[model samples]
Each structure stands twice: as C-alpha cells, then as structure tokens.
Target: MDMLDFGSPRQTYDIRVEYSLLYECALGIGAFTWDEVHDKLDIGQAQVLQIKRQMSEALRREVSLAGLHHTWRSVLFLIHRCPYLPSTTQEKHLPVFMDWLKEIKDSIRTEAAPYLGASYQAPLAAALAGNALDMQKLLDEHHENPVIYQNLQYLFAVSAEQLLDHIKRLVEGWYEEVVSRDRNVVATLEQSAAQTSALSQNVSHEKLIHTVTRGGEFVAEPGVTTLWLIPQVSYRPFTIRNHLPGYAVYYYPVDPDAQTGLDKNRLISNIAAKHKAVGDVLRVRLLELLAASSRSLAELAQAIGASKPSTHHHLLLLRTAGLVHVDGGVYGLNVDEVLALGEELCRLLKLDGVKAAQETSQGR
Candidate 1:
C-alpha cells in the first residue's frame, strides 16, 4: 500500500544525464504558473507574453472543447516517455515515439479492462483524465473513481491524435527558439551532475541523493533497477518523479538565472521554514517525542501538553519543511533530514568548506 515502494533497483552500468525539450514545452504549456514563467524562465516578459498569446491562439479549439486539463493531458501522454525521447528535434524519432504511445494505450486497455467499468472505452477515458503520471495510481483508480473513469473516456481520445502534429511542432519550435539558446546553462547542468555523481561514489546512496538533490534521498526499493537523474530548468527546485519498479526518473530542477538567483539559493528559504517549524518550544518537544517512536496526532498532542489542533498545526509545518513524514496514519520524524538541517545551514553559510575554497563554492 506504500505509494513510494516501486519494487527493487534494477542493475544498470551507467548513470545518465540528459535534457528534455519535451519537459520544457510541457511545463510552459500548462504546468507552470504565470509568475514562474515570467520570473523563473529566461524569456523576457514581452516575449513570454507573445508566446503565450500564440500558444493560446493555436490551441484554442482544443482548450475550449475539451478543457485545459484534457489538452495538457494528451500533451503529457505523448511526451512522458522522456528517457526514450531523442535529445533534439530529430524527425526520425517521431514515429518511434508515436509507436510507444500506441503501446501505452494498449497497456492501459489490457491492464485496466477487468477492474474498470464494463464499457469498452473505459480505459482510454481514464488515461485521458490527465492525472499526474503515477502508474500505480493509474492501475488503482478504477476502484477509487469508477464514475469519472467510465464517463470521460472518449471525450479527449478522439481529438488527442488529431492534435499530435500541432503539439510536435510546438515542442520543436519552442526547443529551437528558447531552450537551445541556453547552451551554457545546459552545459553547467551536465557538469554539475558529473561532479555530484563522482562525489557520491564513496557515499551512501541516500546521503549522496540528499547532497546532490538538496531534499530528495534515494530509495533502494525492491524492484527498482535503474535511476535516471534528469536536470530541468523551468521546473526549478523540485524533484519531480515518474516511478516504476525497474526504471525510475527524477527531474531535479535547475535555476534559470544560474549566477544570482541560484547563488542566493532557495534552500535558504526552505531552511528558514525549517527553523520556524522548531522555533516554538512546544514543537521542539513534539519533535523530540516523535524521534523516539512514531505516534498519532492525539498521542503527540498529549505528550506535548498542547491541544490537538495546535499540535496538528505544528506537525503540518514540520511536514511542509520535510522534517517529518507520515506513514499510514502514524507521524514519524524524518530523522536524517532533521539532522541534516544543521549541515544544510552550514553548507548554505559556506562554513563547511575551506576558507579560500568557500568563496568560490556555489550553494550546496
């Protein structure tokens, strides 16, 4: 029942680093907020607004008819197989990608048919619902959402294929115009990945992941065999995931403005949240109690000598700062993350490095 458990790691000889034009386009299309597009992206405000207008004009029919969620859902379904996607807009890979889409459609139908609604279109409907691409949840949702599953199948599927050429063009053009121009940013990302991997060769998998990714740690689950560490620019400071048993992909974001924005580092903001979480003596007592053993919210409230709502609010802050994690109904301390807070603070302040070397170091 654990959503994070996706079997064991698969044995792979090499760790790969690659950029995705598809990822950038997808984020621009639907995932990113207006503030993120204006501030986080390297594009100028006028240019960004122009592109948005063009994109809106181009996809107006689909957006109007099917809604933005369905329109973006089809886009993601086409491009979600990122590891297999070509690095550039090579026309040769287009067919290969389309064939993979058909296979995905087939897999959904076959795997989901038995549990899904009796209607023939049930699987395709669920696929088009455009939920985040968590495969485990995809399989489980027939039980969880039978009505939405059964009703919405054919609405988007009919138009999804027709919009393929337009989507392809949008992705390719955006890559050429916007993403490719940031060659130095891309190069720095590749170099950083190599250095992080080298540094982690002697370290534990979890610690290495934490050091490299800032917040996310690697999990050696039962069926996961390979991990792809892809670096993304538009989706800064979040470790996005597409998890599977043998193969998993984590999209770690890169700052668009590498010099100043990244130099100041957002981890300082997150670290401040961490400080605020434990700033109250009552919350500190709650963390201490949870460190010994996992406890329910009521139990934590009783131990902390605070009301349930107050204790729950304190726990929410800790959870937001990634200092605590919930498993089942039991709240447990994220012990390593809590411990690494000081180390993170030291790294942020440049106190962990040698004096001369410290000045030249980027935010950890």
Candidate 2:
C-alpha cells in the first residue's frame, strides 16, 4: 500500500528545512540511506521467513513473541511507525535507518526482489542498531512554531557534535552517490553551443565566440553548447547594501566573566514551586488545561491520558502546591490568583529574554 495514498499525510512535524536535508542526503527528506533503504524493504521478507517456519503449526494461527507482533504485516506496520517519534537525538542517522526502510519493503516485494533478499534486513537492522538519529523519535514530531529559533533552542539538550557529524556525512554521501554522477557538463556545453549557434546569428547571451574542446579544454570551441550540471554556486544579492550607520548601541554583559550554568533541576523546581507547586510535565499540562477550561477529575484524566489514581495524585500535588483550586467538580486556575500567575510567567519570560540577549551580546 502506498503510505501517502491515505490522503494528504497527517500533519507531521519537521525540525530542519526538510527539502534541504533531502538535497543534502540525496534521498527524499523522509527516505533512508543508499545501502540501508533497501534493507528496510527486506525486514518484511525476514518476517515472511519466520511466518514460513510456523506454517506447519496448523494448530496455531499466531506465535507469541516479545512486543507481541502477531503477523508479518504487523511487523511491517510497526517499522513503518518507527519514524513517527518525538526527538531526534541520535548521534548518527545511519544507525536507525532501517526503521525507515519499512516504507520500501513494499517495493522489495516486487521489482526490487532480486536485490532485496533474505540478507537484506540484516544490513538494514545493523544500520538501525548503529544509527545516531533516534528512529523512534525524530521522524515526524519536530517543533513547528514560527519561532523556529526558539524551537532550536529547545533542542539545546542535544550536543553540537552529533548534529554536525550527521549533516556532514549525509551531505558528503549525497554528493558522491547522486550528484557527481550526473553528466550535466556535456549537456550544458552542448546547450551552450546551441546558444552559441543562435548567438552567432546574434542571439542573446552569445559571447559571439565559437568554443571548441581539445585536450580537455573548451577553447571557445566555436559553437553553442548548453551547459548542464555546471558545478557552480552563486547567490544574487537580495539588496544592495549601502551601510548608512543610522544608530549603534553598545551593550555589555552584566558580568561578562561570570561563569554560570542553568541547573535544570532547580529551574524546574522553582517554576513548579511558583506555578504548579511542583515542576513536572503532568502538572504543567494540568495548568494549561485548566487555563483553558474547568474540568472534572475524569476529564483531566482523559485529557492527560493518565489513570484516575495517577491524575488524582497530580491533582493533589497541584492543589497542595497552591497552583490550582478545586470548586464543585471542576479544577482550574485559582480565579483570584490567576493574575499573579500571569504576572509571574511574564516576568520569567522577560528575564529569560534579557539573559539571552546578554549572552548574545557577550558572544560578540
């Protein structure tokens, strides 16, 4: 089945400029690598091999297994879902690439069957095991807010080295495998010649010089040839810059030499204490939900996908933390203290902005 045939694909998130990534990798943005892309296509075949083993067991339609995969298609489906994860922290995209190979398994079932045999999944799985990109996390859940830079800042948890290495390998491999092989030069030269002919007739863009190639030199080869894949990159200026310095402001860090680090634990604890009385994802979700609408314990549980007992525990924490107030059967922002909460959040955001600005200035 075509994965994209379901309709316009679901709204999935993307961390970077996805097309740029595809251009760099030589595969579609969501495609797997050269060696491993076919391997994912074979994992299903491996599953079929397993299914073939159990065919003689007529008494059972299913064989119990870890992860409880009941059939080959289900296994394929699971792999297909692997690329829909929430984080992209893999040190290398090569490792979990097999996870993406799930998509091509269908292609392997037909035209690619010869190359994608039983041994195919082995390399694919190996690539997955070695991949640095989290096959389960980074696939489609990247941040999408217009504040793209803030979304990047949210990824500060990731190390810079991992990002750099993945991009470097991806771009280099793409250039070697897909880009350099194109014989665009001859085509371009020919097209340029065609233009040359047109131009010898005084056509536009004719240097009025026929060009020739001898000893690997295009000595103005006296002909019009269109150039193709001429590995030349240039950028046109968006605007002419006439630097008329209208204003300049000099700012210094409050303590340029001060060494400081944000203690995530303390930051969470402080925010929690100030807001939810406890800094936690659940409580934060609760605050957000409450801010929008008053809801009962059951509604809270359903909204947060937590068990009643779990939701209760969190509600208790929030109530005790004095961040929430319960009334009737609904829980929500303490109507009386809501203003204070807003003030606090605004102050915090402002403070963070100031600190960020200070750091940026100091870096200069």
Cα lDDT over the full model 2: 0.36
For candidate 1, what's the RMSD? 19.4
Candidate 2 on 1-364: residue-level lDDT in tens?
6565556543221111111112212221112212234334322333223222212222122222101221222222222234532144322333344344434443322211111223344443332344434422322233343222222222232333433333334334434333332333223323433443343444222222112110122122212132211111000001001100121111111111111222233334445556645468988888889989889999999999999999988987666445566666577665434455566555656877888899999995
Worst ten-residue run, lDDT, model 1?
108-117
Model 1 CA lDDT for position 45: 57
The C-alpha RMSD in Å for every predicted model, in order, reads: 19.4, 25.6
* TM-score, cand. 2 vs. native: 0.21
TM-score of each: 0.44, 0.21
Model 2 segments more than 4 A misplaced? 1-272, 275-278, 335-364
- For candidate 2, which ten residues in a row score worst on lDDT? 233-242
